[model samples]
Target: MDFSLQQIWEHTGLFARFIIFTLGFMSMSSLIVIAERMVVFRKTRSDSRNFASKMGAILAKGDLSTAANTNLGKDVGHLGRVINSGLTAYRISPNDKDVAVESVARALERQAQREVQSMKRGLGVLATVGSTAPFVGLLGTTMGIVNAFQEMAKSGAGGLATISAGIAEALITTAFGLLVAIPAVMAYNFLQGWVDARSVDISESSNEFLDVVARNLTGGETRSQQQAG
Candidate 1:
């Protein structure tokens, strides 16, 4: 069997060709998701770094009022969005320290979850491709083998050599399936790891932000009482 991919492809039946095309589409979908997620993560990380640098000083000073309702000037990233949510909550709530602090805490928690979920967008597609591609290819191979046997029976031939070419063509889909699956699984794992790392970062930042908000609110109330006294 002097078989190249092109030769095998040319000889493949309609169903085998359809399976190949399906696998090809799956491969493309996974690649597109991986690339899109990579770009989004990179851009968002850059924006986060910039936001932290610009806002860190004010936040560290526990000047919640100063940082509240800040103008982002552009689409902000994860840290920016979470922090802004807390600040907006703080600013909008009434002057009760406990109530305001509680509001900010809740806002931070919700926004952090939202950011993590946003970061995780498109990962489902990667996971689906990784898990399903092999099965899809297997389906193609099974169908191909069944067809191959039918052909042999029709021709009244009985031997492995007689059906070798058909079997080889059928196995090609399995090979292609493996090829598509391996990279998708690897990419999914890699991107999932990145999301986990960012989740940790968000958790830490949210904690720190809550601490700052609580202290600032408490201090403001104490000062107001002292001045009144």
Candidate 2:
């Protein structure tokens, strides 16, 4: 290669490709987050609707098996899983309804935390790409500029044409990098917010379900017993 501006562009293109790769991965991460959120939404909605109805019925009839299986069958989402965990725990110690409800709530809370962690998977990578991709592109741009300046020094040409190619390469690389980074950054932020909100919803719903279970199990029995004693 004569090491001209065109040569520099060719090399810059390769660097641009690297930026592209980073952006592509970032896009995939965003998509994954979106998919997870969608799944969570659907499952949470289904769980909330069905859980209350089924649980109420099960509790009314004192059918622990159906209630327990309802929890198992719910694909409502992470929150459902948490609710199910609590319900199952309660089922295991049906005699101590108060203690069982409390134990299930704790277990469900822990499971909810884990599910929240799972929902956050790959988010860090997206954030890293969004925050650092531009810098990576700038690195390539800087390299291209250096090469251009070197050519200028060697050519001893004092015209815009002499450096135009190099300048183009530099600008192109930088622009491409920004293009890659901006969307990745945006998606990362959007998805992060969505994930946090989803987790909150899960926690709230799980807690509410725990309350329902507690109320059903105790049913003023504890209060009446304490008053009697």
Candidate 3:
């Protein structure tokens, strides 16, 4: 058996060819998704950090309007959007502390859900490829073993040379499948971790923003009561 690339391709059976083609497609798709996600996460992380710094300064100065308008005409990330949502809600019901707090809380929750969905996009495909690629490879290996036995039976000889070619060709698909699967699995885990960490940041920021809104609202209500008294 020559066992070269040309020889393997030429000797590959129809089933083996189909399996290899499928694995190749999966690998390519996963790579594309990984690249796209990397870019998206990077941009969001950068934007969020910038938004956080500006937002901290604005909040420290008690400028709710500026915080609300910070991302109005500009591109912002998940944290910015969430903060804007809460501020917008507060603006809409400025006088009623209870209404403002409730509105901001609801807005934060809704924005969090949307951000999570955006972060989780394409993760399903990676998970599917990681979990199933190995089984697909195993199927190819089994098909190759059957092919080896068939060749032996037809030749009426159990010699190594008689069945080795079929066995080798069959094993090629399995090897290729594993090659596709390992990276997909590792990438899936890495991206999942990134998403989780970002989710935590969004949560913490939302909580802090809510506390600020609550305190301001409570103080305003107390001052109004004191003036009335």
Candidate 4:
């Protein structure tokens, strides 16, 4: 018995159709997230690089005030925000070296956490779709097999023709599930890697900024103590 795609779709039972619809929805959602994240990640990377280059020269001159103010600008990214937090803390309590260092460290940590959280938005959905889509499809397959057996029982004829429709539905739904799941899993991995790389860059930049602040603060303290002596 030959069956066309249209014939198979028309014959697909309610449960199998529902599973296919669910898979379609998941795929669409994953695609949306992938597109949105790609744009955001690209812009963040570009902005961070620009911010780092501009601030690097300023920090070399021991200009904490300028560095702190740069973060408020529209062009700054995560690295700038982290650096701004620490610099703002230091500027507020320049003479209290211990307090300033502690404050800046805390600020950097907080900002890093916030940035990571922001980057992780929508990833949970992707992960859920990647992990559960196959199982959902499998459920459809199970339902299809049951339906095929039921049809065989009803017809009283033991032949492939009696069960072909159910089998086709089962295969179609399973294929659709894999189609949705494979791309979703690949996208999740790629986006996760991008997030990790961005995080590393932010961490390294924060550390460099902290080192510059520490040196300037320590030098100022040394000069003050020598003057007192």
Give per-candidate clash totals.
Answer: 0, 1, 0, 0
User: Which numbered prediction scores highest in lDDT against the true structure?
Assistant: 1
TM-scores for all predictions: 0.96, 0.75, 0.95, 0.95
126 in model 2: Cα distance from truth in Å?
1.4
Clashing pairs in 3: none
Candidate 3 lDDT over 72-172, as tens digits, reads 34557888888888888888875877878898999999999899899999999999998888889889889988989998998899888898888898888
Instruction: Kindly provide the TM-score of model 4 when superposed on the true structure, using C-alpha atoms.
Output: 0.95
After aligning candidate 2 to the native by TM-score, how far in Å is the CA of 26 from where it should be? 5.4
lDDT per residue, candidate 1, 1-229, as tens digits? 6689888888899999999999999999999999999999999999999899888988877777788856865666888998898888988988998888889889999999998999889999999999999999999999989988999999998999778879988999999999999999999999999999999998899889989877887888899999999
Tell me the spans in candidate 2 whose CA falls farther than 4 Å from its real position: 1-65, 71-74, 220-229
Candidate 1 local Cα displacement, residue 116, angstroms: 1.4
| Residues 40-154, model 2: lDDT tens digits | 6566656656655656566566555577766346355565566677767876765677677768878888888888787777778767767876887787678777878889999
List candidate 1 stretches off by more than 4 Å: none
Residue pairs with backbone overlap in model 4: none
- Whole-model lDDT, model 4: 0.85
Which lDDT values do the candidates have, in the order given? 0.90, 0.70, 0.87, 0.85
Worst 10 residues of 4 by lDDT: 67-76
Q: What RMSD does model 1 have? A: 1.2
